[model samples]
Target chain A: MTTASAEPLLSLRNVEVVYDNVSLAVSGVSLDVPEGQLIALLGANGAGKSTTLRSISGLLQAARGKVTRGEIRYAGQLVNTLSPQDRVKLGIVQVLEGRHVFEQLTTNENLEAACPVEMSRAEMRSALDRAYTFFPRLAERRNATSGYLSGGEQQMLAIARALMTRPRMLMLDEPSLGLSPMLTTEIFSIIRRINREEGISVLLVEQNAFAALDLVSHGYLIESGRVVMHDTATAMKNNPDIQEFYLGGHGVNFRDIKHYRRRKRWLT
Target chain B: MDWILFLELAANGAVTGLLYAMVAISIVLIFKSSAVPNLAQGALVMVGAYAVLAFSDWLGLPMWLAIPAAMVFMFGLGIGIERHALRRLAGQPIIMILMMTLGLDIFLRGITLAAFGGSARRMDLGISDDPLFVGQILMSRVHLTGAAVALMVFAALVLFFRTRRGIRLRAISNDYVASWSVGIGVEQGVALSWALAAVISTIAGVFWGAVQGVDQSLSLLLLKSLTVAVLGGLDSLPGAIVAGILLGVLESVVSGYLDPLVGGGSRELVVAVTLILTVLIRPHGLFGDRSVERI
Candidate 1:
């Protein structure tokens, strides 16, 4: 498949994130989310996947992390210095990892809380209506406190709340974490529908390689805070190394595959 | 054992409790938004009362204008404290924030002493202190007016929380990071909490000043307010109100009946004992939400 000719909606050029002014968390990574495209960032644990997402969303500052050496451009404008709230106002919203909904707030209030400060009462109501339509399960439990909702329902609320901002691009961190297989499949399909129907670009970070690669049009494999492989979804799925290590293919013995060889294959 | 005196003391205690509720609600608001217990709350209250005194007595403003003017000044002061002092220390351990508040309490007290001198001044809002008969029992008009005002403020707070803006503030209290992700300004929310707390503290200070005179001892109300907060659970608004009334009535009855028998000044003892009993028996307070563990 050919890449879109227009400039990407969000682009990170050689981004380097440093934590506490000492430790490097994300090093020299570059990626893009073309307009209206679904992209997945696949990585192992502590591979800086969440850090990259946080950097883009301007949430790294809260964690004592900074994008020290790269430009994070959203819609052709530099946004490295923008506050997270400002980023959301500029149409960038992130669904934080672990489905962090306002547990004490009712489901409807959770969405209402996400509406922009300048939004009119009529606009807020319609935005809430749009969110509920996307997640009907949340609508059914609108008045219930979010903490009492099931895991799947909380994830839905998190996404729907993000949607209340009417974001041009939605970045989700591990939407499938700790969810049942059936629920994960159902959520991924809904995400695909949102991308297609709402025309919102998505930058997804996930560990479920099989499901992620199947859903995204393009995928980037990250390791040790750097991108090791970038390819179309079909190409990455067929790569032997990704198949052996990430996709759980062939059930190869751990001792049989040499670590150096695996590293060299991806590096080359 | 005069029934008339007993009824009068109880009625007065209930009104005092309403004032305590206002101050405790301020503490709870700061705690909810920022997880800081605001050791400086009493100082804020004292300063608020002194601000009113400065406006009305020193500047010769009318009581009507002075009260609102003082509230606006205190509101700005609250935001300034949060923005200039506390916001700079974000990402530090909460204990550090608590220590900062402790230090702020001393700093504010010093400033008040240097500026106002250590003298008690009466604040007359023109509300009559004359006792009026409610059936057989007598009630102070000052206390009655204070209670009515406190209840109205409580109603306003309840309605505020139901608005979209208030929901945003509530969302910040729930999770700062989550609130930020959804476009909420966490720092602004915290600052607004401080501003609101300051306004409430000013109102509490005015009532306390009207009754007891505006002295440095006005800051001692913080101790009673803290006890009320602890009894109601530090984060619960309704709990603070109930606890405030309960402590108020308890103090009045104990001091009224037992003071003559044990000399004077048993009211402070009631607060001390109630605080201890609450800690030992119900550490979560009466209305606090208990953390539930899901297996």
Candidate 2:
């Protein structure tokens, strides 16, 4: 994807995040989401995937965490000093780790509040309609207090809220977390639909590798706060090491797999 | 009959409640956005009132000019305080934030004493304080006017929240980080909430000082407003208005009947009891959004 005079929509070059000036949360994580591309960040909990996303979007400040080193550029300009809200204006929006919808607001109000620019009544209504079309469940529960939404519904609301901002790039953290397989499928389809129809660049950080890899064209694996691997989704899916280490990667011989796990050099 | 006495106290309480609503709303606005409870809210009200004194009475500006100038000053002061003191302390423990506000209260009070002195200062907004009788119920026109102003402010606030900026306020209050990523300008939102609260406090302080007379005792208004805020739910704007009025009535009624039966000065005791009871029963405040669990 690297071509002269063409820049990735979102680029992180060796970004490092340190909390409380000491503990490193993310380090040397360099990757890109080219415009019109959907990229997957695959990692387990504590792999600093969320930190990378946070550093990119500037939420690190809220948690007393700072990006100590490296650069994050959006649309070919340095945005490391920009506030989170400024990044949103640049269309760099992040749906945080949990489904962090405004619990106190109605689903409709949640979307209305996320609007990036002031619009007339008719304009705002059409904007909301577009969001509702993305998740019809949200339309059904538009006025329901979001705190009462089912976990899956809340996740949809979070995405819907992010969409209301008119994001050029949507960075979502763990959209499939705590969702049942059926609901997970429903959400992933909507996400895929959003990408296909809207052309919003996606940087999806997920522990649910199976669901995300299916939707993404490219993938990066992060481990211990560092990028461990990168490939096209198809190549990563068939890669022997990834399947054995992740993706329930085991042969039918359970004892052999257990012995293989014991002897695994990476585990040590 | 005692029934007449009850009606009188109730009417009186409601009037006072409206004025308290001003203080309550200011506290609620800051608390909703910043979650610090703005211990200096009452002090801000005191400063706002004293600003009017400095503007009109001291500087010899007309009442009309003095009022707007004071409000503008208070708004800037609020923004400055948030940007200067509170911004640096972001992500601190809630206790630390609260104590910082307490320090602000002290600092403001010291400044007020130095500027205006400890003696009570009086200023009127040209509203008559004459008694108006309704079926043997006596009402002060000054207070009735204050109630009208409070209602207008409350209505204006309700309308403001319905606007784009207001929605952003609610969003910031609900989730600062989420609001930030949606282009809501969290720092500016925090500063604006403080500035908005300060503007409200100026209005409240002007009315309050006009009626109660300006003194160090004005700072005590914070405690009563905080009670209203807690009763209403610190994050709920409507909650502050409703709880403020309710607490005002409760205080007036308790002090009128219950205080005399015991001795005197039952207002503070009643407020304390009500706040404790409300905490035990509905810790989230009456209008506060329920912290529902979805396990």
Candidate 3:
């Protein structure tokens, strides 16, 4: 599944992100998302997964975070200095965590708001149609205020809004967070459809290792801001360490959990 | 109990309220996008009056040409202030931004004083001062024209918000990070907000100048407009309109009936009391959205 010879759509090489010029959040992280391929970045809270996504999208500035080292290349062009809007123009978009949407606006208005300023009325109509085709639930509630949407519905709207940009690479911070198991499966299937049908490369960051590994061909395991393990999803799922700590497999005694952390093969 | 006097005062108050609504709209525009109350709004209004005077009276441009020229000049000024002054202070505390606007108010006032001198000047937009009769209620022609223009501008704004660009601005106001991720330029939106606010303030200043001759005191319109913005809820556009009218009528009725009893000055007192009561009571104003917490 690794298209190593092809130029990746987005490649982050030795990226280091520092916050407020002092605290280091992500250091020496490297990864790639090949064209039209779905990739997963699996990590726990504060593991620098979201930070890496933000650095690529140029949203780090808002959090007073700066990329101090390494280069981020999109479509074979260095995008380290581009503004967030510029990055978006070049077809990179991120849906932030916690389902951020224009709560005051209707679902229709939320989608319309994401269209480029130069988009014509005809183009806008087509774009709306495209979003509706992907998330039919949103079309029914198009005129309802987005703030009142159910948790699952709002997550769908957030993804639909991101699609309004017609992005080449869609990076989701966590599409499955807080969603019920049933809703999570539904959303993941739709994400797979978008990747397969629209040919948009995806970089999904999720803490739900089971669902994320099921969705992507390749996975990167991040720990405290570094890429600890990168392998094909099948290879990672079969690894004994991953099965013990991440895949919900029980083998060791409860008291030895802390000791097991020290024995992680990758850490050793 | 003069019924006719009461009706007359109410009519006049409503007209004055419309003018206040125009100014309040300007303040609301800036606050919506940046979440900073533009304390310099009144100063912007005062300078707008002077800018029009400089173009029409000094540069000898026609009234039709001068109005838009002044708007263009102020538009550039608005963008400049946001880019050079306010943009640099991004991520600072909200208080720092508030203080910066206060500094802008004083700086603009000083510049106006230095350039235009400290004398009252009549801005005759050619609207007659004669009282016009609308079925027994006498209204000043200038007031009627000002109200008509304000209404038209309000209608235009409502329509603007329906456009794609306008919707983008609204989205930016709703959430900056979301807007940024979707490719809406947040900085440009903030700059555009300031430019539009400055343009609206110019229209406000013109009407205010027409009603009462322009002078250093014109800058004090900020106090009345601020009262209206706060009373209307700082972020709500319709709230500004309703609150402006409410404050206007309240002030007029207070001044009309109570001024004689109190010996001549109660309008300012009425405004102060209303503002205090609003802050203490409804704090979110009549139309402002109450912050909601989702469990």
lDDT for A58 (candidate 2): 86
Estimate, for each residue in B23-63, the C-alpha lDDT of model 1 and write its tens digit. Answer: 99999999888878899999999999999999998899998
Per-residue lDDT of A156 in model 1: 96
lDDT values of the candidates? 0.91, 0.87, 0.90
What value of lDDT does candidate 2 attain over all alpha carbons?
Answer: 0.87
Residue pairs clashing, model 2: none
Q: Which tens-of-lDDT digit does each residue in B87-177 have in candidate 3?
A: 9988898889989999999999999889988989988898777879887888888877887887888889889998888888999889999
Best candidate according to TM-score? 3
User: TM-score for all predictions?
Assistant: 0.95, 0.92, 0.96
lDDT tens string, model 2, A1-268?
A: 4551297888899999999999998888899999989999998789899899989888888888998999999988899988887888888889987888888788988998888665577878888999999999889999899989999999999998898888889999999999999999999999999999998999999888888889999999888788888999999899776776567665547776676546543542
Expressed as tens digits, the lDDT of each residue in B179-243 for candidate 2 is: 87677778888899899899989998898999889989899998888889889987787888888
The reply for model 1, stretches above 4 Å from the true place, is: A1-5, A256-268, B1-7, B291-295
lDDT of 3 at A208: 90
Off by over 4 Å in 3: A1-5, A251-254, A265-268, B292-295
Q: What fraction of the reference interface contacts is present in each model, in order?
A: 0.95, 0.85, 0.95
